[model samples]
Target chain A: MIDRTMTPLLEVRNLQTHFFTDQGIIRAVNGISYDLHEGETLGIVGESGCGKSISAFSILRLIPNPPGKIVNGEVIFEGTDLLQLSDREMCAVRGNKIAMIFQEPMTSLNPVLTIGHQVMEPMVLHQKIGKKQAIQESIQLLSKVQLSEPEARMNSFPHQLSGGMRQRVMIAMGMSCKPKLIIADEPTTALDVTIQAQLLELMKGLTRDIGTALILITHNLGIVARYADRVLVMYAGRIVEKATAKKLYSSPSHPYTIGLLASVPRLDQDLKKSLSPIEGQPPDLLNLPKGCAFHPRCRYRIPKCFTQSPELEQISDNHEKACWVDVH
Target chain B: MKSFIINRIAYALLILFFVTILVFSLARLLPGDPIQAAAMFNADLSNQEIVSELRARYGLDKPIYIQYVIWLKDFIQGDWGTSLGSGEDVLEMFFRRLPITLELFAGSVFWSLIIGLPLGVISAVKRNSWLDAILTTTSIFGVSIPVFWEGIILIYLFAVIFPILPPSGYVPFAESPIDNILSVILPTFVMGTHGAGLFARYVRSSLLEVLGQDYIRTARAKGLREKSILLVHAAKPAMIPVVTIIGLAWGYVVSGSFLVEYMFAIPGLGRMGVDAVFARDFPVIQATLVMVTVNILLVNLAVDLLYGYLDPRVRVRGNLGQ
Candidate 1:
């Protein structure tokens, strides 16, 4: 809603994240890149272990060391490469300029701490605010998240709250600092289906009201379709398709994107038609494939698809796909 | 909260009852009769006369059940029997030495916590580093070395080698606080090293497990300082198990370090208990056992209360609706 024509707020350039295990190196996020405009909601849709979460963690430098490392990447946030910033500088950015909410709300909160103390933690740490003022603000934050009886609930421990309420508390914590960007890694993945829709809607409305950009990493295409302004379809640690949410859904170019869309059951579509699940498991990151990683599972594979990899190429205005075939 | 505590207290009482019976049976189970052990020193008295006199004085001629009942009645009414060896009131002897044992226990636990908790935290946070490696090796050595050998080694260093402190004997703190500490310092070191080593290993493992939890990552995500994250976020839950081990070790500490006490000649409960055991002092042995069992029970109860305080989930699990 605000300043859509300005330069991008975040630009991730040729990111390469690898995991060194006993067996061999796993190219988790291999040569992936993207951009996010101010107040843009970018949905990263992929199957499990497709590197969606790792890429987001890479942006924040949250990857566990020794086994995992961002070998090559330039995560430019507001003209500064986040990768180049010192850990102290990054600390100032994390939970201040950029905040992240995790998938499992039940396990993500500290069991020993009261809701008030936890929610007030960031304000006290980053803003240098007194505990009294932080608690008062935390009550307001809890109310903003629609938690009932914010004052009484503030004294309650995480175990006392329901799953949905814990998630709402997590959202309130993420929004407390009014950060420029918020990363939600499958925020509603652990919630009930009905509660899932409610949380997604709540997150969308809050991000909009606060004018904060959101990176929603999820496997649910329906969630992305409903909330994302732009979508990136990832397969085996690579973005094979990128476009506006409507364009990507209506005229999906990549075979993987098409397969993903076909697999989703639609209420508006013909009822008799069975959903077509994509065959074959996601390729192992350690051994991948000789050329194109998706060629082994692609039904439209030609001989060239096995020996040669395809780079993301523009096929239409603001739409890109990494496929040689003209599916359109 | 009230119910849990009340239940714990009830459980402690039950344990105390069992301990009393166990100690009573244990005294009987030992080789040779208490009368025969006492008679060895009085060779002038005939065997028949000594046996009959001791049997009449200790009520040993009665049935075992009646004897236990008599002892329990006397115990409850503050009429603890006299020691066969010294002919003094066993309760009075124990109480006279109780202050020394209590002081040693408090000093050892205080030093252990002061030494162990921080080392444990540092080892966990800097896991795999040289500091962790060195601390781990130190803990292993501390645990493996015999307490007597450690006491002797410490005496050799501070008392013999340096000659700045005395090697043996305890001085009451009331007499001179500095001299009292100087005399017991070697024994205290032996006890503290054993406890600190144990606590360091436990705390390290617990902290490592807690550091890997999702909440720790959340604390980091919230931009909490590393110190705050370690102390407030990671330490509290980790301390639950550490508290348990420390609580259990409280029995060992308070019951008195027998080897350390004997080596240093401290007039503590452990030394008194061992001497009573050798001399077949039934009343003194029974009283010491009961006191040690009570100490263990109280320590366990404190740990449970501390567990509730550290992790509120334990207290709120049943009353979630409230």
Candidate 2:
């Protein structure tokens, strides 16, 4: 449940991240803005190439430079403009205030280092704690993540752990400092379906208990349905639709959002009716289609949708959509 | 770990066995007859009867297989045979020079690591910068310049022009450690130059690949300092490939850099090996090749063990096999 009266925990204003390649300049996250309230789970839904992951990366300033750069953005976290902080100051805020869980749990953990060492590192680094205390805390964190034999598991390398187990270790590391926010980028995408459910439940339970805000970035609508309180549907680097979980599922106004919801097979839907998937590919970021980027695949495209791109406008209380023609 | 070491040692022994056969065959295949070469050294042994007697005494008249068996037996028994040129026991001569060669080899490796590793790390971290360009260019020169020419240039600069270090000589470390180091410094540098360049190129490329890995990003996200991310998280895996190169380089150095030893007048195994070749001293040549082959096998074994240590995946596999 979100309280609208208090200041949001994190505010991103017109964030634009681009990649300058030999081919062209890719507008990865083009002028995306959003607010993440305290103790809320916000799901960013998009296809592979859309700006879901990039936007999350931009908020933390983790975009690799030379090719990828945050050209314009104001990421204000806890009354401080993060983009304006010095590198040292920003580092002090990173693991202590906001921790990240990457997608590939297998590759995300260092192969040479022990699981205990990796989990305990953030505590020692940001908390400035002694090794013995960090080790003690890490064992508890491991067990809290429901890993078996937490004591022995600490000395084991990443290669020794299963994917589910490794992701749990990542969660433990993310929750090590008890940060205010955790950005889990496709955290369970690489795991089995059963493991995915268990992990998601674990993450939800943990965040709720600690009151940590979570930004769950995933392409899976089902995951968003089960977890997120508010959802932002992204299409070609812009937020096409934003609404609470219930409203977006009930009355998805944007054609792209409507197409996305229709594509997933619902348990209540007719067994014989095949899903109607969105037609055409996502527009290339390098050379996007003029006007609405989704216009090519959008079913309810008017002539105005062809010449002029639509900005995200409020449709009703707690609901917004970027579309020229209203689907009533 | 114990089983892994034993397996490696067994494999090394097999390679050593083959190397013995190769060295024994190759040494005898040389053009000159050992007895004739021996006669040239001894003016009194000009007649055919005496030459035949000398051949019989040295077992040169026996069938090749029997000769090999005898040589192998004698080598196993630590009787390395007398040097044709110096008439000294080959094993004793080797022992006398082993310390000098070991010092030179050690110093070269030390200098190469000191010069190459940091430069390589810096170059990779500061990629496309002026410092990287300068270091890369210097490495290029190090790799390309001829060793003899570099040795000569160093000699001319330090010994002749400046007259700082002795031009060409060997000082026993026991007599004077300071003079011993001063004398070998130029030789070691000359020997290490190519290795330094090689290591720099290797470490830079290896580290670059490692820095791009997902784990490095995770390390950065954990808010680890850039130094810790590069040195602690990335360096171990990056060094896996670099260690192989170092092992090969060490084998090369240990076998002796003939040109470096000769130019510097350091009485090392390489100098002995080259002198043996000129004199057609079959026993010394055979001994040197066998020693080098063993050294290379031992180094390769150590490299494999070190590789397993650095990468846990490899260690796990090794353990699983046991």
Candidate 3:
């Protein structure tokens, strides 16, 4: 239900991130572009090392320097290019306009600091509110995340809490500033199955309630189907496919996307039928295959796929695929 | 918390008991006999009968276990006995020199923390920079250099060449604060340089490790200023290991750096302990050993309590009686 005519909440144009290691340059997130509408939930799906996390990191410019750098990109959030902003100006945008929830919730929160202080920090920093007011807001945020005993829990350190509770605290912290957009990078990957469902539902509900746009990075296609409005399937360092969640699930275009769907075990399918996992390992970023990064692993690769990379081309309304061969 | 403290105290007492026994045995095991050494100073004590009589008087003629029991009994009742060499009360001499040793220990700890902590933090924050290289190299030199040599070099530079501070000596702080400070500066500096190096290395590594933690990224993602992130969020966790190092170092200094004390000619417990060893003064040696052992034990206890205060994980475990 994205209005194509409306201005996008976030627009990432030709973003590229590379790592300069002693061995060689690692092209982590190759040139990629995407747009997110206001209040939309976009899921970036990929196996490990596909640069889904790196892509999200690039949008926020959180890539660690020395080894990692966003070489080229325009992360236009709310019509302003974030990459061009000064460090001071950038600080204002982070956690204020765009907040992020990290993968490891247990280690994401400071071990020594109390939960209240951590949750209250962004509010005090961005909102310029008093500690007394920040504390009250923090308690409310904790409660909103469905954490029990929010008032008493405020004084407790992170180690005292379970992984699920810590993730809830992280959610509370992410929502503390009432940011315009939230990037949850595999937020529930570390939790139990039930907890993951509950947390994601809570996150989707909360973000939707607040009319905040979300970009959920995960390898779970089922999660994307359940929560995301739009989906981007990444392979190697590039997005191999992008489409609406329903359209992508019902009619996946790219060979990599097709393979990914086949790999995941479907409850509706017969139990005796085995999953068909994609063949071969992800290409080394230092020395990728001299064509499409996914070509070597793509079962539907043609001669042209071996010689040349395929650019993301539109096939129909709201559906794009980067592949030489037509899967369907 | 109460149980944890009580548990630690019980452990400390057991350690103290073993220390007393060890010191008593080692003092007896020394090459020279206290009575014979006393006899050398007094011509009348050349008589064999007189030597035996003196040994009997000091209860040295009794079996080792009985002697230990008698000494322990007297020690517990506040009777430390007279020094074999000086004939002065062991406790009296200890009390008289305790203040000077404590002052030196305090001065060294203060200077080391002041010099080491900031340097270490700066080194880690500016890692791979020219400043980090220089600070790291300087700390290496601090750690490697001998304390006695450092003391002498400091004396030659500040005392002999510049004549800014006194070369060696102890002046009661009550007599003149300025002179007292000037007199101890070189000794404290010599002692603290090593500790400063150790602390700098520990803090740099610890802080660097902490900076790489996920929470640090979370802090950055939270829009916190770099200063607040480094000082507030990262510093406390980093200081946990540093606190343990500081505690062990404090115990070492409190026990007295004998070489530093001797080279500086300071009338401190370290000097007394060395002199007592050479003269085989059993009472003074025993008393000094007891004092040092207790100081180390107490510092260790404080460190454990501090661990509980700094790390909630430890505190929670303590509460759970784990």
DockQ of each: 0.74, 0.80, 0.76
lDDT of 3 by residue, A1-328 (tens): 5576899999999999999999998888999999999999999999999999999988777888867998998999888999999888888888988999999998999988999999999999999999999999999999999999999999999999999999999999999888999999999999999999999999999998898999999999999999999999998889999999999999999988998899999999998999999898878878899888888888787888878999999989999999888898
Model 1: chain A TM-score against the true structure: 0.98
Ranking by TM-score: 2, 3, 1
DockQ: which candidate is best?
Answer: 2
Q: Clashing residue pairs in candidate 2, if any?
A: none
The TM-scores of all predictions, comma-separated, are: 0.97, 0.98, 0.98
lDDT by residue (tens digit), candidate 2, B11-42 = 87888888889999998888877778878878
What DockQ score does model 1 reach against the true complex?
A: 0.74
Scanning candidate 1 chain A in windows of ten residues, the lowest lDDT window is A1-10
- Model 2 residue B87 lDDT? 84
Tens-digit lDDT string for candidate 1 (A55-93): 999988988886899999799999999999988888888
Please give, for residues B1-322, the per-residue lDDT of candidate 3 as tens digits: 8888898899889999999999999999998789888777789998999889988988889999999999999998989999988889988989999888888888888888999999999999999899999999999988899987788788999988999998888889999999999898889988889988988999999999999999999998988878989988998899899988988887776454778888888888888888998899999999989988998889888888887877888887884223
Provide the overall lDDT of each model, using Cα atoms, as 2-decimal numbers. Answer: 0.88, 0.91, 0.90
Model 1 reaches an interface RMSD of 0.9
What part of the reference interface contacts, as a 0 to 1 fraction, does candidate 2 reproduce?
A: 0.69
